[model samples]
Target: MKFTFFTALILLFAPLTSYSLSQISNPNYDPELAEKLGADDYGMKSYILVILKTGENTSINKEMRSNAFVGHMKNINKLVDQKKLIVAGPFGKNNNDFRGIFILDVSSIDEANLLLETDPAIKEKYLKAELYPWYGSAALSEYLESSDKIWKVNP
Candidate 1:
């Protein structure tokens, strides 16, 4: 049997269409887990995304900068312990001058700003924090449990 262009296209898209339909009517859907994670119908929720950047206080004072960063790390751990920060990491050198990012599990930008105030880096002007509202998977924080085990040494 010879396949036409239309037949080939239909065959290529058939699986994707069925897969999409299956996902919408997922048999593994768990209502209890959705409630626990504060997930909406799409298994997603709102969060605060913070972008940390180099601040105006570019003082060459090594000791002060070092101390501020030390405090920054401690503050991150504290926030993680409190289940407020879902994700945190530094970005590689970039033209945007972006230093780092934090996906905070907070309801609003005001709340995220309040928590950032506790960070010495932001408080001391060593770093600036920019917060934005984000919508993402509700199960994002669940990966943290396994993350701790994978890291052999603390950075």
Candidate 2:
């Protein structure tokens, strides 16, 4: 594990795992926040990550490409607004085949795939996606609800 400062605080304060939640008891806990954060007795959840990569069909026309990307952005915002997508962003300054990623609040890879199929970029073959199961803070799902205060945009 990367022993960062915040990670240290998480391990010390947060219930790093379901088992840890069972072991530790915090007297001062907020019920409303707990429910909002999905911290059922254990603060854990199963999430999915979708990676968007350069697909084979990159020879799209310039005009079509612009529309495709705009449509893709709109689709992403739709997913975020729907709370299916927790986090989504493009990779910058990377020469690798990687393009962008989406952290989806879905249980299974199949569910994530179904959501990704709606992307115009993926439909046009400008970007293809690969999904993998991920586990992280259940509270992360709430980030989308508050992110607008920071980003000031639907993204």
When superposed on Cα atoms, how far off is each prediction in RMSD? 6.0, 10.5
- Please name the candidate that would achieve the greatest TM-score relative to the true structure: 1
Highest lDDT scorer: 1
- Candidate 2, residue 25: the lDDT equals 74
All candidates' lDDT scores?
0.95, 0.83
> How do the residues 43-132 of candidate 2 rate in per-residue lDDT, one tens digit apiece?
767789888899878674899888889999999889988889898888986778889999998878888888888998899899999888
Local accuracy of candidate 1 as per-residue lDDT tens digits, 8-41: 9999999999997776555888999999999999
lDDT of 2 at 111: 85
Weakest ten-residue segment in model 1 by summed lDDT? 20-29
Candidates' TM-scores? 0.84, 0.76
TM-score result, candidate 1? 0.84
